[model samples]
Target: MSSKRVVFDFDIAFTNGGGIQGQDFRLDIDGDTITDKELADYIVNDMQLLMVRKVDIINKHYITEAHKRKPVNLKADEKLVDLSHTIFDGLVTYKGLPAPIICDYLSREQSKVNYEEGTEFQIGKITMVTNTGTYIDCPFHRFEHGKDLSEVALEQFADLDAVTINAKDAIEIGKEYFVGKELRNKAVLVFTNWAKHWNTELYFENHPYLTGEAAQYLKECQVKLVGIDSHNIDDTRGKSRPVHTTLLGAEILITEHLCNLDKLPENGYKFNAVPPKFKGAGTFPVRAYASLG
Candidate 1:
């Protein structure tokens, strides 16, 4: 489906307060035509304004321009690409960390007793450390006084504008790799092609990592999150972890052990990586994905 947009003027009245109005405001729409009620609902949901009592649309027109956001359906051009490593029993992410243990809490045969005849269901249970697979490290992972997973707002992990940096053959990625790039308020993912050696012994040796200068540069740029398709984001040969220290100290989130990064373009898409809400936990696994159209 081709991208379509609506241009119109709107007068909105609040449920208990003043009113708001707009002229020539543009918005993405699903189809070529839309009812005024549906358009009002779209504006309310997208803008996230207060309660609206009623809306009046005027001078409405449709255009065939590119979508700034989204209002597409399954038959449209929007696509969702997975950018995480699948975790199963005995799968190692880090060198020293243990693998996840997956089992069934209630088997189908055992669940049959809880329900009527010919009806059954199964419940699964998993036991593993928070950082077992492709995981995110919040500020609390390094600083005890920083925000935990639950304290981090949901907006930080939803519909975030993102870009990818291709560093396929480099070992020590420096600030030069990230210089002159749009790095502010976006999830900058570094594609290292190191995922080719995933699940192999070579994956744990001499993996790609960001240098101290690069970490400091990203921090200075005020990037929202940093991700790498490698085993570790910091050099593991020594005792010090300067990359994690610098970035996490500034409250910049980190995501390591990412996979399928090559499927994403350098820009023009959104990134979402959300973990289960956990209190007092710093790092946890996430099913990260990229959205594009």
Candidate 2:
């Protein structure tokens, strides 16, 4: 492959009031030479500088050092597996909650008079509660003053190294299942295969759930998030919700009603279940999925 070389001077400023001024440098890069902004980012990352805010290129076309590094091949064998149930109109997810109302706010036939010939539009509207489908629960779901959906960071919900625990036929999952696994900063998904009953009457009754002891163990291990392919993370028949209380109190996000866990390996995938940034809302549906790499 051919290489492109660039010589430039830069001034970099850090976040902590520290700055580097007028540093001349040269770089040999693969493919075409990068833009000034790209060059600045390369410099900051290559130098391993911290808290950098700005990098200004000062001089152009001055040779200094000949450094050669192969360009990274970003292409990888990756696959995305959908782990969410499709939310349909008049389809019930939970027993008591109302089904989503899907209707067209602006019908295509109605828009014919307002538009030119053969031009029409349809605007759709959906009305449903936050807990309608595959949904995420933030700390505010259990606590009145805890972090809401908007307050949770993106890293807590997206691109996390993940592991799946096969707990099929197990109703009360405990900490023993997670004993030997690394749990820190990982999305720990419990697969019970209860999602097979989705859209059926059996999905809401006697479903698999995590024990409070398991939730405490995950909290102690600092797991970033937890998910389950079941009806609810906690046993809904009981009045007390210990699992939700323990997990959410620790600010560990929870995703319920996740499917397709069989598609993911134990540890080779990344998990993402991001919800909308709605203030004052604790729970909302997410398009949960996994990336196998």
Candidate 3:
């Protein structure tokens, strides 16, 4: 039996600068009349995409409809919410109690004579393990010769195209799950319903993980990065972290412990999870987010 599909349509108006609509920028759903049925038909016949039934134009209004025919560049009132959870002291400390003592204080001595009426301070330091909070593991994290955080290019971790694959119903995300899917040169994010355990002890246990075969498939496809809303990308029950091994060995990065993944629509938002630019650090936390307009 085929899975049931549904399509929800809503009209959106976008302008640049303030309220001026640009003629050069057009959102053409297969050169159709921008209706739901035609857009859905285009996805089915032209792209061979599935799970989308139809697209319909729910409403339309000219800029003049609101502001008396004034041409100003304005964007549709869209909000960008952060998807990454905050990093606190001992928030996501490893199970073995190697948690770092995260504190906020001045590293350098404060000015002694400058306490009259001015503000004088020193730089602060946040000491912690490389694998704290929502972090990404580059190739060098698992292998000695693999690319380290410095070795990995900015494009690999930043905004290179991204797509999210929902695996909510599957028992495991294996190679077969990725078959017939285009993954080459894309950031593949796995939504496994694991973000619910962000700060709970259960997050450190045997959570949903990507299988080795899935890793191999992504490797073959030359995926730029792989992210999961789970504790780790590998099966926590096993000693061998095969998923991390396979993907990282192929120079693919791994982002773990993501949150708010459900807010993003599959295959729409651009994924970006960037770590700090540091030398010799194999892993570090990031502010992972998605941009939608």
Candidate 4:
């Protein structure tokens, strides 16, 4: 009998639009030790789950180190690529509401003076809610008993082993969809095809969502994190948020309003969606991104 072996792929592809779809993993065991026929029988008989393990190794490796070394260089005279955008303005506010106001200014103060003879200075403050744009809802957003945004450990938000589930057209995501899958101790990202309605009213109604049973199953499995590229993780029309309640109640962080998830591989790139460490705050906008290293 030959020894058993497993093959892991790190360069998984995350699509460019919204839905999450990519290679999560492909397990390979020695044919002599386990026998191809025996392995197939085990899967048919529901015993293969015991033979695979998906480990989180983000802390032990640099996520963007590969990109840093081999930067994306354009022509020396080429125009730069504009990567930043303000998606949330007066047009579309949180919960389809109004935006915040800005006030206060220090016009006369100056720190250093490359002072022109007729110079003026101004300082100001802006008052906006945390859910101004694409944001993350930590466990504290739902439960007072859970850890607040500041109290959440950094490891929970950054350098996470990410898995993207393709649920774009799925009306309901249930436990059956994830049963027997290695979901424990990893970031479980859901890519619903709802982002297509980003600026339209359709994005707010009848959107796809994870079932309450699925949330409970994830919590029981101890998923490290949960994210969805949708307006809200819960059904907007429903009063009870069983999905959010179950996952957050178990102290799992939730990230909402993610874009470019389609660009991520199902199980390869390192996911990092970090919010500010603000005390007493449960939710905040984040520069959520993935590192394909």
Q: How many residue pairs clash in each candidate?
A: 0, 0, 10, 12
Candidate 4, residues 1-293, lDDT tens digits: the string is 22324322222122342222223323433231333333334333443333232222111111211121222222322322211125433545346466756554554545126457567566776667777667777777888767888999999998888788888777677887778777888888888777777767887777778889999999999998888878777876769999889988888888877766676677865778788899888888778777666
Better of 1 and 3 by TM-score: 1
lDDT of 3 by residue, 87-189 (tens): 7766654676456666547533355355554566665567778888788898888998887888788988876577778886344688876778778898888
lDDT: the better of candidates 1 and 4: 1
Give lDDT: candidate 4, residue 93.
39
Q: Lowest summed lDDT over 10 consecutive residues: which window, candidate 4?
A: 57-66
Ranking by TM-score: 1, 2, 3, 4
C-alpha RMSD of candidate 2? 9.6
The TM-scores, one per candidate, come to: 0.74, 0.73, 0.69, 0.65
* Between candidates 1 and 3, the lDDT winner: 1
Show model 1 residue runs off by greater than 4 Å.
1-78
| Rank by lDDT (best first) | 1, 2, 3, 4
- Overlapping backbone residue pairs in candidate 1 total 0
Best by TM-score: 1
Query: What is the TM-score of candidate 1?
Result: 0.74
Q: What is the lDDT of residue 103 in candidate 3?
A: 56
**Candidate 1 residue lDDT tens string, 8-95:** 9999999998999999988777777777877787788768988789999999999998888756343354388898888999998877
TM-score-best of 1 and 2: 1
Q: Which stretches of candidate 4 lie over 4 Å from their true place?
A: 1-85, 91-93, 100-124
User: Residue by residue across 147-194, what tens digits does model 2's lDDT show?
Assistant: 999999999999999999999989989889998998898999999999
Clash pairs, model 2 backbone: none
